[model samples]
Target: MGELIAVYLTVHTPRYCTYETAFAGKLAHPDFRAVRDGLVEQGRQLAGVQPDAIVINSCHLVATFPTVVDGTPRHRGILTAQEAPELIHGVEYDFPGDYELASAIIDRGRAAGHVCTLAADVHYPLDYGTVMPLVCYLDRTQRIPVVPVSVTLANDLEECFTWGQYVVRAVRERRRRAAFVASGSVSHKLVRGPERWPSPEDQELDHRFARMLADGEYEKLWAWLPEYAETVEAEMGGRHLAMMLGAILESGRRFAAALHAYGPSSGSGNYVISLS
Candidate 1:
């Protein structure tokens, strides 16, 4: 069977901490509720498909190295509950060809000055962005293997895309049944600083991107640049989208929908998206 992959859904905020007063307070600025609801629905759908594994490409988990995808060590049990104490949790899941792909991507990115690594340990918490959507899609009863693909944001688009293509090639070669989820948002315009806020023009720009993603129009996706920068303010997240897109499309699968699209009109512009 081919690799089963799902891209990351943007849960930019700490919604998992149901009782975090600080997190709850900021929820109004960027509708954490919207992101949470969308994530829950996505989780339900993923459980229904029951793929061999899931691939979550997220920047939150990006580190200096490649991780084994799951946060568990080989022989420990990693707990997901918020109250669960951190410990030497067992390696919960492992994806086929993930290590190969991560290693190659890291090497390529490093050559281009983008430092990255692969994690096989079960100690660190698989950051929330990776876990939240996971909670939404995966069945509690069935703990499938997970492959986490992360990238450092310290490089140019060409560099990131080069590394991302390597990631896609490795996953496609592994031939596991998987779905790729590219988890991120368009702009971080929501912060209180001078960052540009989302104007009606920005909304127009997001709509155009949503349309491109829906159509699987790679030519248009690749051509996005001067135009995108004009609307997107900063281009940090677009690379994440492009790299994840490359990985998913490389699997020879066609995307059916932009799935869910909602950016918190706040400057943060965090949005959630799912592709099938």
Candidate 2:
């Protein structure tokens, strides 16, 4: 059967799509440089796995009511991020979609009584949350098949975790080597400055939170999630993190690969973390 190769947690801020285009070359921070270095390192680690396919759950790909899994045979889109069109515009992307894997995930989830659906619509658009990770992680010379997962508003944290359990079953049934990525931030209280970091309180808490995950302190992480999400204003209600945690839980709570980087992007806490 298929085996999960790795789990990655990273940020996909639009401004990082390009080197000089962001902030009109004005915004700069030591954290910015640190994160850039971290991404390069993260990319190197991902490349080593040679994953047959990638399953990504992006915070931006919010589903209507059911969990959405892309089943299209081909994925091609131009993304001009709605949040910041000027800085992240006209970015073209083309990648193959894993119809089989997507189907298996849906079937397994449906059988388990979860609201999971396939998104096979032609040319389904992908948000920056998904694309930016590809840009940062995937090597374009060889276009690996992508199975994009969505965080649905309908499911609470527990349901999302169950959905992830089904995802693991589906991946194993499909018999393909895969990678799962959680693409979003921790402390996401957006303010006016791109280079600005979150408050000292948020910064301290975000570090602790990420450390909890890396340390495989699931009990403590869960215990602190609600307050932490509210206090730091986690992106998308921390659904991406919940799903990632679920996926990891299904993977037997394996130690996090290594948390190599943590930084701030427009007041949000981002990290380049690996868990396998």
Candidate 3:
């Protein structure tokens, strides 16, 4: 049997790292629009893979309690615009991969540190973190089922790691092949806070982080957290990235990350990582 391939990632507002002003002012940047367009394009390519599934793993869709909604396990679902209205309100959203992946992540999350719960009917719109990328990448006509695994609020590292193992194992055990996607962004300081300035050492730190992810060194990735938070923007996706990477490697597959872009367009740290 061929090894299972998963694409784990995160998603954020296009200018997530750049937000440092009032909502209106922050929304005024042309670069934000361009980056937003670029992210969606990335998703389009992901959808093209036509794998057994595409999972959207993120903390944005979390409930008060952690939950995993397996759309396909119970029923077939779609990623139509209306289904993920958070991306574009009032539009029915549907995708083929969303629900299947959601179910898997839910089961994985429960094993990792969670209790399953549904979104309380069909009205629970997917947050933009999911909608934006899925909608952007997927053609309106080509449906991909989606499964959303919402992270928990607890800070238990062991729970997170265990969940990572479950995610990796679940995908590996599937009789069919699949590709997973983690939908999140790197450090984002777009929101205003006293700690919202770009550090001089951001580029150097970004390089180190990108390299660690490329090398598949989970221990090294976790080890850098304390120093990274102090030296660079504190908003980087260390935990999110770590768990996703751990999940992928747990399945015994090596990964290579392409540093698509690692420059400071926004004041906060920003970069795009593609793992293969």
Candidate 4:
């Protein structure tokens, strides 16, 4: 049977060396450096697990109402992120796409009355949110196949969780060893400073949420997500977090979650964490 070996939560930024050499400079912020190191460690642990495929859901790839799944067998592109063209432009990405796994997720979601769709076009683009993590967490040597999913902003938190449930069912059915990566930020209340933390109110909520995650308080975390998302301006309405939460917690598995590192990005809160 297939198994999910680990769940990793990370923040993607165009300023990272792997993503943008031009803008890459010393990570002066202690917490930001720690986050970088933590991500490297997570990638190392993931490599050791030798997962059959990596399933990622990116906040930048938000869909209207359906969860978009990449069904293309091969993904090759030169990404110039419209959002941050100066930092992340003309970055080449060529990797194997998990067609079989993507198909399974789509089938299972539809069967379960969830909204999911497939993208098979070879020319489909990769967003910075998806590309940044791939380059940072993986290298040319790994060559691991990936299945990318998109955020559905129109859906409620419960629906996102249901989408995750379908993913679990599909993974088990296909007997694929998989790793899940949720790439986004917390307390995404943009301000002037790139290194500035969110406002005091949002910072408090973000820390509370982080505490709950690290403590493995899934029940309380789920109960608090709606309020947290609404109050804190969580990135992409906290859709990415909800889906990741569903994938791990809905599996009925207990994880000893570790907060590897956390930092601030343009007034938002970010972290590199592993649920293992």
lDDT tens readout by residue for model 2, 1-276: 687878888778865655352314433565587676676677778888788888999999988789999988888888888987876778777888899999999998888788778999876888888887686445443388889999899888778777777777778889988888888888899988788888999999988997888788876687678788888989988888787777777866466467878887888888888776
Show pairs that collide, candidate 4: none
Clashes of each: 47, 2, 50, 0
Task: Please give the CA lDDT of all the candidate structures.
Answer: 0.53, 0.79, 0.52, 0.79
Candidate 1 vs. true structure, TM-score: 0.70
Off by over 4 Å in 2: 19-30
Residue 116 displacement in candidate 1 (angstroms): 4.7
lDDT of 3 by residue, 49-133 (tens): 5566655555465554454454543222343333323334443455544443445556666664466654424545566556555
lDDT of 4 by residue, 145-185 (tens): 88889998778888887777777777888898888888998
In model 1, where do residues sit more than 4 Å from their true spots?
A: 1-9, 15-33, 64-116, 136-142, 193-197, 225-230, 234-237
Model 3 Cα RMSD, 1 decimal: 5.9
Ranking by TM-score: 4, 2, 3, 1
Write the candidate numbers in order of decreasing lDDT: 2, 4, 1, 3
TM-score of each: 0.70, 0.92, 0.71, 0.92
- Report residue 204 deviation for candidate 1 (angstroms): 1.7
lDDT of 3 at 201: 64
Pick out the ten consecutive residues of candidate 4 with the lowest summed lDDT. Answer: 16-25
